[model samples]
Target: MKPEPSSALFAGPFALATLSTPDGPEFPALVTPDGQALDLRDVFGDERLTTLDVLDRWETALPRLRAVAADAGPARTAVTDLRVHAPVAPRQVFQSGANYRQHVIDLHVAHRAPGDERPEGERRAEAAEIMDRRAAEDLPYVFTGLPSAITGPYDDVVLPAWAEKPDWELELAVVIGKAAHRVPVEDAPQYIAGYTIANDLTDRATVFRRDMPQIGTDWLRSKNAPGFTPLGPWIVPSESITDPDDLRVRLELNGETMQDESTADMIFKVARMVSYASQTARLLPGDLVLTGSPAGNGMHWGRLLRDGDVMEGTITGLGVQRTRCVAEGAA
Candidate 1:
């Protein structure tokens, strides 16, 4: 028997709206331009949707979305008019580091190499300068954070008082759809759910200062601050992205272009990073992997974000996001 077709409605970047079902938000898929939420699980449930499961289904989902759009008539203005939210509200956000050769060079010039091991006093004195200088050099870097830091589309990023140097990192983030660990590098693409844009907010001064041996902890303290990571506006299905690695990324501050580059600059590519990370831990559905950012950050200009500063970023084909920086004490 022919099965009923499934659809999705992805509005405002990462906002995903699925069809109403007895199970509740069936498929929980990403929204589309035509006010339809691609019902991933439903599509997988139906034989007519396709034989492929979620892991390998994206390749087929694109055409399916277009077909649905054709049947729906011209897309509603609301789908194109809404704001985007984080592609996936995951349990955690994994960020990369020193992944770009240029970023490594910048770090070397500002701070010592990984093994250089500078003296305590010297390291402290150079911390701020290193962050400032390194920000100028668009070297590849990575890191990870808890899910609490995750913010939805159009959410404001709070600049804490302890953060003397709050900076922005505009990056491409990947969402995991399948449950797989230690997946071979060649097969890494099979585990992906979709993609989105992310702004990795950093507390530079606090991070370096806490790196001191006297602190007595291995983890970087600067990373734990509240509202550090702002993500979303939308989570674009992998099928929607023709070439994930080739997309162009841009960052604008108060209407001024601050960062512009393509994902082609990545030093560690997505497949390798996914394969590497999965080897140690499970990369489950809804997990977020943030690809590193390109050069051109405020830290490089010695002009970290101030209260009320508007920051925006966009990726070709995916979508754009704008955020306002609120002061620590503001009501």
Candidate 2:
């Protein structure tokens, strides 16, 4: 018989919990909805469970724990006062760009046509007009960000003094549960431990300049600014997010909604992305692959982040994360 939906919903969110001690190394802890934190590393030691040895094992463990909780009910201790950390301190962070269809169309229109006899200014104007027309159409686009750009859940984002066009992208990031190479689309879910919220910060001026002939080919530089990728709050185990592709994702600057859309709008589904990524490189345990963001980002509207801006990003079923932006030289 198939498991009940409620059983799935009870699946715990993954996180690394650290005690408020000044000396010891923080260990991996599993979070329970009732607010209980289990020191899995302490309990399991350096054994297989200490780390999610394999994706399938992690998936299997969820239902097993949920069943135990269901049986224990009133006896199950809830972890209410634990401090949450990033689910996984990954060795690498992989990001996607121009994966959204709307973004692709916008880019194409921005550049001059192959053989069209149009002046540079005319092409720029036409591109702007095209972007306005497609405002309502959510297109898929993808790009990558360096792992060094990553910061923890409550970490502050340092807005560099040189960044004249700082912007934020609210995206859902998938955590790899095992090493996978050439994974098939249908079997991709088996490799994902869970999902979390990610803010893909960008320096727009530097990014745009890279497209010009003079500067040329510096995609990594435009994205790897310090504190550019703020991730976490917690990881919502895959089993808990019944339909990841259908969840609502939104971003708010201060208190105003800046980006709001559903993962259903993604041109390339999560499974496909996993499969595609695996074809070129081996996705090891704890690696993060941030799915592309939707429309309404500040960059699309010619707006840029300023000092003291607070950004909150959330994905339905996953936890919300808040970050404050500090100017480059600010102490």
lDDT of each: 0.63, 0.67
Off by over 4 Å in 2: 1-24, 46-83, 103-144, 209-217
Model 1: weakest 10-residue lDDT segment is 1-10
Backbone clash total for model 2 is 21
TM-score for every candidate vs. truth? Answer: 0.71, 0.77
Candidate 1: C-alpha lDDT: 0.63
TM-score of 1: 0.71
Q: Mark the regions of model 1 whose C-alpha exceeds 4 Å error after superposition.
A: 1-30, 34-70, 73-77, 80-84, 110-142, 209-211, 214-220
Candidate 1 residue-wise lDDT, 1-331, digit = tens:
0111224333223333322343433234435554434444443466333212333344455466445544545333343333334445576567786554444344344444458677745654565465556546633344567777766546677888867877888888887777779898889988786777888777666655445646532224455566666776556767667777887889999999988888887767787777777877787777888887777766555678989988888887656677889998897
Query: Model 1 misses residue 97 by how many Å?
Result: 0.8
lDDT of 2 by residue, 184-242 (tens): 88999988878888888877667745346676545676678867888776666677778
| Top-scoring candidate (TM-score) | 2
